[model samples]
Target: MSDSPLFQPFDHPKLKTRNRIVMAPMTRKFSPGGVPGANVADYYRRRGEGGVGLILSEGVGIRRNGSRPDKAVPNFFGDDALAGWQAVVDAVKPTGACFAPQFWHVGARPDDTTRNLPDAPIDSPSGMPWPGKTVAEPMTEAAIADTIAAYAEAAANAKALGCNAVEIHGAHGYLIDQFLWDATNQRDDGWNGPTLKERARFAAEVVKAMRAATGPDFAILMRISQDKSPDGSIRLANTPAELEQLVTTLADAGVDMLHCSGARFSRREFEGSDLSFAGWVKKLSGLATIAVGTVGLDVPAKSKLFDSFGPGELDEVERRLDAGEFDLVAVGRALLADPDWANKVRDGRIDELIGFDAKYMTKLH
Candidate 1:
């Protein structure tokens, strides 16, 4: 176990962890009325006690009318919701795990008409959730400014709650991704442009605002993906040079780390290179990167979104981590199925690791 880099400690100027295992943020919609209860706090506490080095809370909505599709998704603003999150932090910190709340906004993604804010105006860059699909009016500059401010406010709240860091959900075809993708952002304004770098203005500004709110010591992480929602083959940057430009823009704007999401962590990101998405991002941005996707599953996440899969060997992941391909490894479904995943791996209890079942998603366990 000592030879495996997965158990090694990770140290950075703004972030440090006992091990390299991170609990990837997965939406569990358990918080009622946008406020997490004691159950939510206990759920996170178990992960910390189970030995996860870092735990990123589920996607908590920012202070915007249509920031989330469902009221049960939890919120990062409001006194009641912030108080609920304070309890969560209090519970997890005692177990020796660093915590961060993933601030999110769904953007042009369709809402749950029956249970969500059906009448609220959904915010999008150009009102298109996907290419050639317009559902509403483009986001006005004023609305955009307000959204950015809301993100900054959330970051300040997280810091005040004693969180180690804050993550901005910029991946998975959410509001921020909508602006980054040219197909969804067709506005004839400063926010939209032909080049990917130009399209990154909105994300850059968000990072910059959050940086000012949290000060220099607090770490700010942004999640990015080549695959956008409703389309898995989407590539924000076709080549490494293009990816460098986009990431460097965010790095310049004050992103302390990058969480690169992929369907399979082992898959090569581009031709002629074995480096994965997280590897390339770390190399380009010169910032810590978290590699996530199917860390313990035999099948890719896209292939088994709602089905159970057998356990996968982590020799490759250990090799990559030992090689410094990425700084951290995030496990989602596996951690959901077994909170003590990190401990089991550390103890060389490979056979004891549980396989992920879809049923685990329905409850806090």
Candidate 2:
């Protein structure tokens, strides 16, 4: 127990940490045409220069047209995308920070209006994600195989482009999250079934494919959460026991580090337990963990994106970090509001911390 969250180091054999703070993967939506450019490079470089130990690139689509909308988030597929990501990597490397990109697929969450292209197909675990609306049908066996291959290809490309690692976006009600959630996943095929292990089958296969592609040294991180974004649906092993099982299975499947996401960092995942969701998963899986939420801000980071406000408290975070419940901490909106946030906190200039506003989220270079 260090008695402070602001400054602490996490030492895990798989995850090399320069400091205790991880620049959480916050979607900047700045990439133009799914390609990261100089502006995106500068954005990340600034953060790294300011002392962000590890930088998780925004949710990069595994394939073109796989995202929720025509946003600026970069794509990992294609030669152009690879070159663009290389630029980002080149920019961040000078700061001597570890970097990884979050590989993602939006699944049924994409709207026809948001996709920009009307013909882009949105796939799901089942033909229907919710009632009365059909975006696209469930993935056929061929489609599933193609997706797995795409992940492997993208991972290889990432390694080629000099990315230190890759994170499979297995959370937040995205493609993988859709399959993990029982409500969205109602298929009876080999990929989907009632058993938890079966639900984890697809993700496991993708991980294995990526592992073979990236080799042994490059780290592979996994991001998971109990709640999904957009509607904030509870999914992916909601209970603590089930969460333990889920994390254990993923760890066994080859995740080097587990980034447990949540809306609030301090709250315990299970009732009657002092351990938070990250705490529980770290304890259960015995892996390096990064805890992320509304840390050190006046408002909950995503309130405007949805429709709500979240409680604010830094003392609670400090208390938890002192207890050694989690290895690393992720700052989303706080870092977005101020790129030098980590430096400020470390210099004991907490009074200079800025609150994030919704206006900043839409601005992309």
- Would you list the C-alpha lDDT of every candidate in the order shown? 0.90, 0.77
Candidate 1 clash pair list: none
Candidate 2 residues 1-365, lDDT tens each?
22356566555665566777788887777777788888888999988998888899888887635553556667888777788888889999989777889888777864556664467666677855454556677888878888888889989998888887888888887788878777778888887777667788888888888998888777898898888766665656767677776777787878788888887787677878878888998899988777888876766555465445465566777767677787788888778778888777778777787667767677642
TM-score of 2: 0.92
lDDT per residue, candidate 1, 31-89, as tens digits? 99999999999999999999999999999999988897788999999999999999999
- Give the winner by TM-score: 1
Which ranges in model 2 have alpha carbons more than 4 Å from their true place?
1-6, 233-235, 299-303, 306-312
Model 1 worst lDDT run, 10 consecutive residues: 300-309
Best candidate according to lDDT: 1
Off by over 4 Å in 1: 111-115, 298-311
> What are the candidates' C-alpha RMSDs?
1.8, 2.4
TM-score of each: 0.96, 0.92
Give the total clashing residue pairs for model 2. Answer: 0
